[model samples]
Target: MSEYRAGKAGINAEAQARINSKYNDEIAQETLEWIQKITGSPANTAGDAENLYEVLKDGTLLCHLVNKFQEGSVKKINQSTMAFKCMENINAFLEAVKKLGVPSQETFQTIDLWEKQNLYSVVVCLQSLGRKAGNFGLPSMGPKESERNVREFSEDQLKAGQNVISLQYGSNKGQQSGISFGNRRQI
Candidate 1:
């Protein structure tokens, strides 16, 4: 008899449902459209997470997508059907996107895309890349990238701020509540 797989079906199903719930068809569709527009390649999905995975699993189009932002970002695009080759392509695309200013936190792992474990994370990474694309004057799909607002305070202003007791410091104003915890209710 085969050894019993502990917590296999139940745990896997719950985790799968949780990951599925995080996926947004609309966002996937928008990401697909944006990728198609940028790479000039037609995707074969209807914007669903599964379709999106199929469209990006090979990582070829992703490499092309990053190249659009920075020429030759991914110097070589693999054309092999082997698993490692496909993962290499994904890694190349990820590294290229990182060079293009996509935050490390925003990018998903190779297995996340390869195994289809977390397609939502893939979509989120694409959305983050789309937002970062705006920084390069490209037509972005998601929200525009926020511009850095660096404020330099003068010495006098800094000194003035030090003298002020901000509300965040919790000034009680010498007041105390008459309530107590862990006591029986008083009727």
Candidate 2:
């Protein structure tokens, strides 16, 4: 009877391990799908897998959910208002971090590296989870599109506004004549 009981327990343990593996696999698949959807990038690097695992392991899932909710709420608020609130959250987190007296440089360096790798969404999500776990004062700054130098504008040669100006194209001017503007309307 003892031998039979031992066998049963071993079997149960093995089954449990399999279940855990399957669950992990499902989570990974879901996370990959999410990343692909968000980034519109087809290829997945090993770094992406590791990063996703770290995020889920470190209680960042909660933060992602919180961000989703925040985005939904922002849908109701005007873009400008929502942007202001996001900026406020970022600044508030920064101030709170300083008040907590942690090494600001180290914390910022970690955040900066993650941002440079385009992992700001994950950082934001993880920070949200950290806040809920009584680890408040984490700065949750998402990546700004401006981090990349690429810019977009209407292809039409003619744009008119009080703040708008015209660019005269000459063969003498190469890419330098890219029609630079200042204090121009964002519209």
Best by lDDT: 1
lDDT of 1 at 178: 60
Each prediction's Cα RMSD?
Answer: 4.5, 21.8
Q: List clash counts for every candidate, in order.
A: 0, 0
Model 1, position 140: C-alpha lDDT score: 84
How would you encode candidate 1's per-residue C-alpha lDDT over 1-187 as one tens digit per residue? Answer: 0124333378788987898799999888888988887888754647887688778888998998898898899899999978799899999998988888889999999989987778888998999999887778788877777878999999999999999988888876776456468765555
Worst 10 residues of 2 by lDDT: 72-81
Clashing pairs in 2: none
Instruction: Show where candidate 1 strays beyond 4 Å.
Output: 1-8, 168-187
CA RMSD (A), model 1? 4.5
lDDT of 2 by residue, 4-102 (tens): 333325876676455434333334444445444443433552344344534333222322333343333222212232434434434433444444433
